[model samples]
Target: MHFKLPNKYLKYGYLLALVPIFFLVRYYQSHDPEVNTGESFFPSCIFHSLTGYHCPGCGSQRAIHDLLNGRILAALKHNLLFIILTVVLGIKGYYYISKAFFKREVVDWTYNKYFSITVFVLIICYWILRNIATPPFCHLAP
Candidate 1:
């Protein structure tokens, strides 16, 4: 199937809308660096609270905060999944933006079922490993 550009308003407007939200997230992460603390405005992960186990997205907020502050190692320590997914999404976003602006056809691996399954399996494994208290697994925790 050919990649068709949507209406101009919807196409560029969506990106324009995201600009403020992006800045808002950056500003919040900059001002409130203690997302892991109870006193912070960010809500605790409900899945983790209910199950007493780290969810796939646990520590993402803190990871975002660390990433915004240029603490790449700390961000990875908080949530490796977040880092990995961010990189993947960034690459995907680049392709999408290029397609929208430059009208270029690129090899988008996201359409492959194997890529989807791999990401799903990775998330499940990361979720389980982060909850395991064993030596190597313990390091995966937030």
Candidate 2:
């Protein structure tokens, strides 16, 4: 016999997948050394290592580690884009959960083209600025 989950139950499968991710992040929070300290199992950015230029995601691992440890500013310092997206995603998650569980009416922004374009532009700008060696842009380096 074959069993198919009902449509209403599909979302719960996604929640179950997040269980392992939550534990992994918790493990990283406590046991993982800072990625910036030059010792980590986390893979170094190949784009940066080979090119000697900061990639758009250069310090994201460190930022995630710091954010998990409640070091908000440190996370922002590592990757401003990551922090901004974290906040944006956090809000989106909150809204999704509230609407799903509580049956609240909500305007979903998930498919907004303008938001997508803005994020793409921001990433490209960040990738370029983070590689610059001059005063203001140098600080953008991870």
Candidate 3:
């Protein structure tokens, strides 16, 4: 008997390939040491750099860096929301890959009205707390 991959399998394979690339980038960033301490190679967040204020995504890179370095507390300090969001996204990605490759089922994610409303409320709260709650709360900003 001969084996051949289905189109769906090929798509799953491509996605799985991204997993390694993701780790590679994480490893490089974690090991480099200089990426975080010095002026980052990427553009500075214009909002923070100029105004000393943070946007919602301000500390995401630092959070990821801390997580990659196995510093959970530090990561959370940088951006708890970013850490939570990354975990949620990672789980969703894993679910899709598993469905596509192993289960041979279509991936479907549905958020009920309550969940949607809760998420919306949480986002608004986070935004207001980060901007207005004072220094320590705003530390999560960036």
Candidate 4:
């Protein structure tokens, strides 16, 4: 049995594209700053700074760093949405890459109107829920 690159350009291009992601994860791993720190090592979220509230993306940078450092619970504590999005996107990327490079027939993901609306509502709810500093909802804040 033998395997070969799908195409010369694609093979090199795919590997080259990964370099930046690799470096980004590496950077995060090295600079794992806590989300609630006064002296933030990572770039601050402008929305959070002006509003004194956690934006939908407030803790995503710290979440990524925690995830890279093998702190799954801490990562989730920072931003559950980022973790969920990463998993969803990883699955999609895997399917597309396998289809393109291995000649595998990957099933297409269908976009349904109801599903789209549900996701949109869920995100809005999550945003609102995290901002609520009461009971279980308070735990959602980073």
Candidate 5:
């Protein structure tokens, strides 16, 4: 039984869904998520709240908010890893969308063992660096 998804739906549907996301990011760019001011509605990091330490995603919300507002330096100050990952994932999305438009298989994203391992290691390193209290790594904390 070979049941395949219709190309017409997959292609246009993704583009339609992206419209709200585009507006959402733009809205965040202007409306201010207010992540750092202690007045933000966003939930606190459970890992941080319980362990009293920074987690890999501690400042990602603030980083995204800053990034959307074109504050590159401030975004990096909040969470460099999130910015990097955003760019990487954005490129991946571009690839998938292009393929979808051409009516190709969407699962064409190949998994590379080495690349996955490297990303995992980098994320772990960032998690550890953000927790360090020293001068060099201290800036990584949110």
Candidate 6:
């Protein structure tokens, strides 16, 4: 007489829960005029309200928004690294989910020391270049 949920069902349930949250966030964004909720949320972007220097994740929101709105060029203009990272993360997430739910292993890339070092190097390089470079490279803020 006890109800037990399967792993797939739980994963889908979590996804469903996200739907209402997304709608609510969209509604709030649409309704609030003064609340700069998008790329502006990050204080490090050149276009944002922050007075100091730029942060590495500054233009990410605008990038995501532009990408979602079918403006690939504009999204790239905002933050190329952010967009690329998003795509990579999305692919990784899909692979992980499929493997977890369907018991099907798509790829056999192991996360080892080399992988960690590569990711760390990439992030550090991105951080240094974005902060020290000129306007356009600085534009890669997010």
Better of 2 and 6 by lDDT: 2
Model 2, range 59-95, lDDT digits (tens) per residue? Answer: 8888888988898988888898888888889889888
What lDDT, from 0 to 1, does candidate 1 have?
A: 0.85
- TM-score of each candidate structure, all chains considered together: 0.86, 0.86, 0.68, 0.82, 0.81, 0.66
In order, how many clashes per candidate? 0, 0, 0, 0, 0, 2
What TM-score would you give candidate 2 relative to the actual structure? 0.86
Once superposed on the true structure, which residue ranges of model 4 sit more than 4 Å away at CA?
Answer: 1-8, 35-41, 110-115
Where is model 2 poorest over a 10-residue stretch in terms of lDDT?
A: 31-40
Worst 10 residues of 1 by lDDT: 31-40
Looking at model 4, the pairs that clash are none
* Residues 49-139, model 3: lDDT tens digits: 7877667777677777777778889878777788878876887777876786677565445345876788678777776678765676756
Whole-model Cα lDDT of every candidate shown, in order: 0.85, 0.83, 0.71, 0.82, 0.81, 0.67
Candidate 1 C-alpha lDDT tens digits along 11-93: 87877899999977876666654534555577778998998999998888888888888889999998999999999999999
C-alpha RMSD values across all candidates: 3.9, 2.7, 5.4, 5.8, 3.4, 5.2
Worst ten in a row by lDDT for model 6: 27-36
Residue pairs in collision within model 2: none
Winner on TM-score between 3 and 4 is 4
lDDT of 4: 0.82
Name the regions of candidate 2 deviating beyond 4 angstroms.
1-4, 33-40
Error of 6 at 23 (Å): 2.6
Candidate 2 vs candidate 4, TM-score winner: 2
Ranking by lDDT: 1, 2, 4, 5, 3, 6
